[model samples]
Each structure stands twice: as structure tokens, then as C-alpha cells.
Target chain A: MNDDDILEQAARWRSEGKGVALATVVSTWGSSPRPAGSHLAVDQDGAMIGSVSGGCIEGAVVLEAQEAIKSGNPRLLEFGVSDEDAWAVGLACGGRVQVYVEPIE
Target chain B: MKGALLDRLLAERAAKRPAALVTSLNGGGQSLVTAEETHGDLALPLNVVAAARTALRSDRSGIVEADHSRFFIRVYNPPLRIAVVGAVHIAQALAPMAALAGYEVTVIDPRQAFATESRFPGVRLVTEWPDEALGALRPDRRTAVVTLTHDPKLDDPALEVALRSDAFYIGALGSTRTQAKRLHRLQELGFNQEQLGRIHGPIGLKLGGRAPAEIAIAILAEATQVLHQGEAAEAEAAGAL
Candidate 1:
């Protein structure tokens, strides 16, 4: 929601020793609901920070963010249609996006 | 550098600065498996949640005030950062998406006309030429540089800077032919094959279309895969993360 709310929560998690992964929506196309610069924080417990698209994509992102944290691997995750993504995440509107996923250290 | 980055991000977040945190990945002395957050260390008292009234009483140095119920354990050491060169239309779409995915975004462009504060309201906009910008911008490991400027003068110099730096994601925007031409120039300028390997030309996912916004999405989407799911096949890479 608010920036401080997120900071407070992220700080609390860090202080309390909770593993957290930060996910960001780096790019989007075609009537995507969320704007770019949206931030989502996925902790080990699956708590989320900012939103990427809308309700459509966050759940999926949380799963990936958690895995990233668990695996200690950072990845660029994408959603929607492209030549390569003809059968992937496939958004409802055929909108495409860039998601950079990394485990928070 | 890591500590300062953390401090800056935490302080900015704490102060509601709304500024983006951009980390240089695998830069000199940067590690992939063990890359540290240039920012993200914001600790506050956990006891505050238990006794809301006493939050102010706690001794806070590196500590801020957070709910005592909240816990802090480093989950991911260093998050990735996306550095945008040329805050153009594509950047408008790209910056916010990068932020949404949790990547700190920094926009560098010499064009004040295009790289103005209004264009990118929430992100960081650096009104400097790419050469000077990358020096101060510091393209490190885990950091990505995308050049959207159609002009080679703008993107080329930046590519040189980005290639030389430790930035993992170095991309230049143009057609395949344009990219080849640009590469030829880069070669003439003394960029070897190894150095050229680092640059991603004809930037963005090959979406087979040409809308600015759509192109922006494609570029960032491809960048996402490279930055996030570099190993996965390009076809299966697009998904929420």
C-alpha cells in the first residue's frame, strides 16, 4: 500500500529473521491494470508488498518469489504473449510484462 | 558500498522518499550467489507491536520502529536492479514494471525533454549523457542497462560504458540490421567478441510487432527473462514471478 507501510513490514521481517523475496513488474503491455514500478515483497510466509498487475498475476508472482528466496537464485520472470511465450503465462488480454525475480538477502 | 546502499534504501523507504533502489549486480567484487543488497537493511524494534505505546521509547540506531511481531531474516541477499538508459516511451512502461517486480529502477538519459520528472514520476531520472551517467551510475553486477535511444550517439557510448562495467544486463534497442550496424561500429571502436557477447542487441522479446508501448513491454519482458529466468527456454519464460 503505502511506502512506509511496506518499509515497516520489510524491516520487521528482516529484523525478525524472515526470508523475503522482492518482486517487481519491470514492464507491461496492452491495457495492463497495474503501472510499471509496482513492487511486491514475498516473504517466506507468502506475504506480498506492492502489486504487479492486478489480482491476476500476484499469486503467481508470490509463488515464484518464494521459490527464488528458497533457491537463492534471482530470475527474470515474464508473463503474457511474445513469440517465445505463445503458450506461457498468457494473460487474459494478451498483455505482456517483464518480471525480475530475486531472493532477498 | 553494500552497507551504504542498504542505508540509502532503508532511509529512503523510511522517509517515504519514493526513490528507487538500483543495485549493480556482479560488479567488481560483486557475487551472483552471494550478492549483497546495496540496500534493504531496515530494522526496527519488534517489540513495538506488543506495546504500541512503547515503540518510541526503544533505543534506535540502526533500528527504526516496526511491529514487534515482525521479524527480520535475510531471505535473498541481493535483489536485482534495472538501469534504464534513455527515459523514452519504452522506459515509461519499463521503469514501472521493473519497480513492480521489485527491481529498483534508475533512468538515465541526456534528454531533459524526454527524461523529465513528469515522464517518470516515481523512478530516478538522471539527466546526464550515457558516458558520464554510467560512471556516476556505476553499472555493477546484478545491474542491467537498457539503451532505448534510437540514436547511436546516445546508446552507443552508454553500451561502451555498460559493457565495460559489471552490469549483467546490457541491451541496446534497434532492429536486427540496426543492431548489426551498431555492432560493427562497436567492433570498429575496439570492442572484442567477448565484450560484444555481453551486449543484447535488437533489445526486447521478439514479439513481431512495432507499437512503442508494446515494444516497451517486449523489451522489458525479454530483459526480465535474462535477469530472472536466464536459464529457462525463451518460450516458457513469460510468466508471473
Candidate 2:
């Protein structure tokens, strides 16, 4: 989504007394679908802003952000197509991303 | 107060400035306790719709805080610039792509016929000689330059100027042989092997397509890669740290 859209959503969340969190696609490796710097904002209610991956990783990232927003903690989440423990989330292009999450309430 | 900060960010972005909207996901969100209204809280708290009413009216920074637990919404302004030194077919394709990719594109060419408004729609076309044109273009960290002229006389001086700057990517289009000759000349001009290595010679990734549009896509992709990778040497330095 555009920066304005994201900012608008963020403002809306903060005003409503709801917890908010921002997730950024800080870095991506090999054959990634989404560009780095793509952003998504998540509220305590599972609402989202922007998009990181097409649809593959948003749910996972939203879940991560929700926890942070609720707990007022931060985290770095990773999703990739690595083998062994990669059965849950497997990207077709073997893309991996480092997500920086910050809680905002 | 939080609303005012958010509105500034939106305005900057709408104005086509490279503004970054930083949200707090899992990091400690910066608290702007002083950002609160000194008057008092609303009996019915001002919703965002209400907040946006005078969002741009105030100079309040955009951060909301209850305590140490707070969220930051910072807008970072980064300029978007692209200097394209050519009026060739590839440049025609590349110019709009730069615009679509959010760059303030400047097309510098010695040929007025080749570099015109009709030819490059929405591009800032400067029909001037290369060396002089390159001098006008600012090469910042966010800027990128592409030399599609494939002419040593036009490309060399501009490329030299670009090489000395902090532009994220410097690409020159042509086959490997032509690229080799161009680099040889750059070397004669006193650029070392390491500096010469910085150029994305034979520009664009090996998309193996002859179409100008396809070549443009490869160049965009390569540019995006360079922008995010943060430089291999810098990455290595970070690793060492």
C-alpha cells in the first residue's frame, strides 16, 4: 500500500485506544516476490496495513505483530523456504525475509 | 498531537517526496508524552477523523504514548532521483519505468530530437551535452544513473562523475565486448580496477531479452537489488562488526 494509506491506518488505530504494531520487510534474499522496504501495519484486532508478501507471509507476520502489540514487546520474524523445518511456509522462489516488528500503542 | 505527525507524513508522501512511515511492530516505540495536548484529554477522545481535521494545522510530532509502552510513527523524507544519460530506445523504455518506480527522472542527451517531451513523457528531459548535464545532476545515496548511449564520448565523462558520487547504482548498457572497451577507456582516465568494478557494465541482469521493455525491467530489478543489498562491502563490514 502507499505510505499515506499506511499512515492513515496507523493514525486510526492509535486514536481508537487500540494497540498498533509496524512490520517492515527490512531485507529479502533470493527470488523474493515482494520488494524490500515493503511495509505492513498490524493492529491488536488482526487488521493490517500495506503488504509484505503477496499472501504467503502476511498472515504469519500479522500474527507476530499482534503478539508484540499486545505484549508491548518487539521481535524479528523470519519466513523462508529453507529445508528441514521449512514444511510450514515454503516460498516457490526460495525467498527469505527478515521482518522488523515494533509495537505501537 | 499523534494525528498531526501522521498527517505530515501523508502530505510529504503525496507531494512525491520519498517519505518513510516507520511503524513500531516489536521494537520499543518512542513515546512523545509531551506530544499530548497540554489542555487536557477529550471527554470523548478525538478519533482519527477528528484528529485529521487540524492534523496539518499543528506542528505536533506523530507519536502516542501511555507510558514506556508507546508507539512511534516517524516520517523519514528521502528524495527520489534518477539521471539517465541517453536518448536511445532503451532510454525511452527506462525513463517511464523510473517514474513508475517513484524516481524523479532526468534525461540528459546531446540530441534535442531524441530527447523531447513527446519522446519521453513525464521525464525531465535536458537536451544538453553529457559531461555538462551530469554536472547538474546530484548523485546522492538514493539517486541512480544509467548510461544507455553506448557512446564512449558521451558516456565516459558522465560515468566518471557518477563513479565519484554516492549514487546507489551506476549501470551502463551494451554487450560484454562494448562494455570492455568502455571500461578500458575509464581505466585510461585513471579509475582503478576496484572503482571500475562498481559499474554494472553490460547493464541489467541477464534477462536474455532483446526487447527494450524487457531490458528496462532487468535494469529496474538490478537497481532494486542494489538499493536493498546496502553494498556487499558494507554488508561484510557489518558482519565483521
Candidate 3:
């Protein structure tokens, strides 16, 4: 889905009384899978749509997004190839990506 | 991001208006900036709004720093459109290719027999006269208009409308001699040399292919080249300015 579709889904989730968090790739250092404005929308029930770092960090980001939805606070998470577990999840492309996760209010 | 602002953003997109959504990372504020007006209460600075408009024109989304605040400007332009003004064999090949390349393809031909749905599946077909269809479509900078019909009554009228519009690429399929004759006729109609120069007569990259599909490939390739390189040239011009 495009950014608009993700945002629209977030709006729908909010109206439906379900907690929602929007994760956006705010910046990338190198060889990022998606561009800076890519988004991922996660609901309170773990239902998710869209993508941020292709498949490398989506699970981690989704977990963090659920936490943000609960705490009602935004979180900025960063992932890079130099991380210890980078190779385990296939992010060893010598790149770093910063994602911002914020709850929809 | 969940009230009037989101509503307006969706409305603008639905109406096919060019817009940008600016989100401030530090403050978590959002603003919708359109060519006609700015919506929402993000309290964005003038410089940020200016930068957002520039991003809209470039049809790209990225982060911009203004006054120590980093804002993501998400551009929302209408989909790229390509109107092929002849539902011939070439149009049959080009329409599907253009659609596959993520362009909204429209095949226009007044002849009902040629503009059938079976020939061009899942493509918008217009059976009106070329000029009438083009006028209604109003090809803009995001549009590329190509005239494939060799008939003067059909191709010339469409070319006239395309030249006057802001379409990024205007191409006509013809030989050198045919193009010269067409240019002479257009010149007599009072089009300046520079204006006529916008038409890529003998259209498409010279791939030396005679098959209809091969010709279509060349045309689409040339159109893509012009669309991207033309934007680069305009960006250079703007930077120089």
C-alpha cells in the first residue's frame, strides 16, 4: 500500500477505537531497501500493513510500534549493518535506517 | 494528522490536485500544502512551505531541514498519463507497455471499429475526435501525448493541442519527409519554430525495427527518456536561476 493508504487505515483504526501506530523511515544512511518516506501502520492487535526497511527490521519495528501504541509516546529506532544481529535478519547490506514510530491520536 | 487535515489531504488526492504533506519529526506536527492554499495547523514556517512546494514540483518525497526542524515532505501528484491518439496496431502495443510502466494509458480514436475494447483490454478508450479528446484530457506536465495515425486530419489536430498544452513529451510517428510537410503546415498555422521543435517527429529512438511491437518499444523508451531527462534539464535550469 502507498503512504496514503497506510495513513487512511490508521485513521480508520483510530475511529474504530483500535490503537494504531505509524512507523516511517525518517532517514537512511546507505543501501536502504525503501526510501525515506516509506511507512508501516500497525494496529493494537498486531495487524500491520506497508513496509519500512523491506524485510530486515519489520518485526523489530512492529514490536516497537505496539509498545508505542500502548505508551502513547513516539519512539525513534535505528538499525544498521554493524549491529550484532544484522546478519541474522539479512540487513548486512552495509546500510543504516532510522525509523520513527508514533501513535495516531 | 487525524482530523480536518487528513480529510483535506484525501480530498485533494481524490480530486487529482498536486499536494504535499509536510510532517515535522521533532514536534510531530503535520501540514498539507497545495498550489492554491495551505491546510491544517502545523504552524510550519514560510521557508518550509516553500521547500514543500518545490518538492511537490519535483514529484519526490524526502526530508528537508528548516530552522533546526527536520520535516518530511511527501509529494502527492496525479499518476503519469500517456495518451496515444490512434487505436492502431502500434497503439495496441504501446498502450499495454505504458500501463505496465505505471502510466495511465488512454487510446483515442474516433473510428469505432479500431477503438474496440478487445484490442486494448483494461485501457481507457476514447472514440471522440483527437482534438476533442485531447482538449478534454488537458495533458499537463505529467502527461505524454503521442500521435500514431499518419492521417493529417487526425494527427495534425492532436499535435496542435498537445503543443499548446504543458505535456512533457509530444511525439508524432512519421518519416523525415512527412515531418517536414507537417512542420510546414503547422508553421503556416502560425506555430513558431521553437514551438514546433517540441514535437519529436520521426518519433521514438531509432532502433531500426519495422515490426509494430518493436516500434512500440522504441517509442516508449524514447518517451521515458524525454520525460526523465526533461525534468533533469528543468531542474538544472531552476538551479541556475
DockQ (C-alpha based) per candidate is 0.06, 0.16, 0.43
Docking quality of model 2: it rates as incorrect
Collision pairs in model 3:
none
Kindly list the per-residue Cα lDDT of model 3 for residues A4-105, writing each as its tens digit.
677688778878999888888878888988877788999998899989976888888888999998898887778887877666666766799888888876
Chain A vs. true chain A, TM-score per model, equals 0.82, 0.89, 0.92
Per-prediction TM-score, chain B alone: 0.64, 0.72, 0.90
lDDT of 1: 0.63
Q: Model 2: what is its DockQ?
A: 0.16
C-alpha positional error of residue A44 in candidate 3 after TM-score superposition, expressed in Å: 4.6
Q: Over 4 Å off in model 3, which ranges? A: A1-20, A40-60, A83-88, B175-181, B205-217, B234-241
lDDT of 2 by residue, B4-113 (tens): 54455555556644332333333433221122331212221233223322222221224333324223333234445789998889888888887777677898998788
Worst 10 residues of 3 chain A by lDDT: A84-93
Cα RMSD to native, each candidate? 15.2, 10.0, 3.3
Whose TM-score is higher: candidate 1's or candidate 3's?
A: 3
Candidate 3 per-residue lDDT, tens place, B1-241, comes to: 4456767777887787888888888887788999978877688899888878777776657788889988888788877899999999999999988887768899999999999999988889999999999999999999999999999999999999999999999999999999999999999999999999999989999999989999999999998999888766765654411
| TM-scores for the candidates | 0.51, 0.60, 0.83
**CAPRI class of candidate 3:** acceptable
DockQ computed for model 3 against the true two-chain complex using alpha carbons: 0.43
